[model samples]
Target: MMRYILVGILALMVLAVGLLSFEWYRGQNQAVAFGAPFELVDDSGQPITEKAFQGRPTALFFGFTHCPDVCPTTLFEMEGWLDELGEEGEDLQAFFITVDPERDTPEVMKTYLGNFSDRVTGITGDPEKVAAMAKAFRIYSRKVELEDGDYTMDHTASVMLLDRNGDFFGTISYEENAETAVAKLRRLINEG
Candidate 1:
């Protein structure tokens, strides 16, 4: 009886391993997918969609123009990285999507982004649409009321890297090392 029980356990273990291996193989063969559908406008008020992110690697950042530090710093860093990459990064695109659409309109976005590389475009639109887009992109954003009855925005500070097919590849933290950031961008360009 003990030997029979041991054999039964062995058979179950083999069956489990086979099932796990099949699932793993299926997952490996599945295509990678990320984010949801979104429709917004660029700084020029041009209708932009998820299709813009396709056909090339993209550096996507979400922040408000009113951002005191993180937004401006990330924009500057992005410009530098793009400049550093030169021709190699020509195919790489950068987009700045506003988390505070109430105050960051197309005009505001265009003027603000003017300080950075023209290669970097700004995206904004109706508040509800913008919120939906942000949600679909899995970005976190909230409004903070100040003592002056004013307001500020708290949002994600990382720059998301997307492959040529617009799949989420990785991210560069707000203060990620310059060298490391550049390396990640380089890898995205080459691999995507």
Candidate 2:
């Protein structure tokens, strides 16, 4: 009987240790917040920081105003998603960060973003600052020279979804299905 009790106690101790180890491993592996600190300017030339990404859920897109298709299309769809969500998404905020800061000044961003939802704010700044911000967010952008001595940017076309706490949540790919995209936004607002 004593032997059985000792074995039982040993089993219980092993199980306890296993459970604790699992919890500890999970805590270690869980993501530590998202995004790096940044100092940039909004369309109105206001100093904006990573703090803008907090306090409310954020939909952040990285693209250049000169993008021929993806940028405008994504912005239009983002506006629609916001409109579709309506009051439900009142707590949500959207941002457009320029990857081509050399050509996209604050004034230019203001004019370019005018065609999108007023809820969407444009972010641009010094080229180096913008590049650093893009790198921190894992956004890829490169300039491609055209035959006419002009240039265009090749950039990531996904919109990053961040929770109110500014943690990485998910993304909305360019030209994502409207229903699926709206559903993702709704989920972000409702759960994030």
Which lDDT value does model 1 have at 115? 90
Clashes of 2: 0
- As a TM-score, model 2 comes out at 0.86
**Model 2 off-target regions past 4 Å?**
1-29
TM-score of each: 0.86, 0.86
What do the candidate models score in CA lDDT, each in turn? Answer: 0.92, 0.92
Give the per-residue lDDT of model 1 (tens digit) for 1-192. 999999999999999999999999999866545677778889998999999999999999999999999999999999999988989889999999999988998999999999987998999988998898888778999999999999999999999999998888899999899999999999999993
In model 1, the runs with Cα more than 4 Å from the true position are: 1-33
What lDDT does model 1 reach?
0.92
Over 81-102, each residue of candidate 2 has an lDDT whose tens digit, in order, gives 9889889989999999999998
Pairs that collide, model 1: none
lDDT of 2: 0.92
What local lDDT does model 1 show for residue 171?
Answer: 99
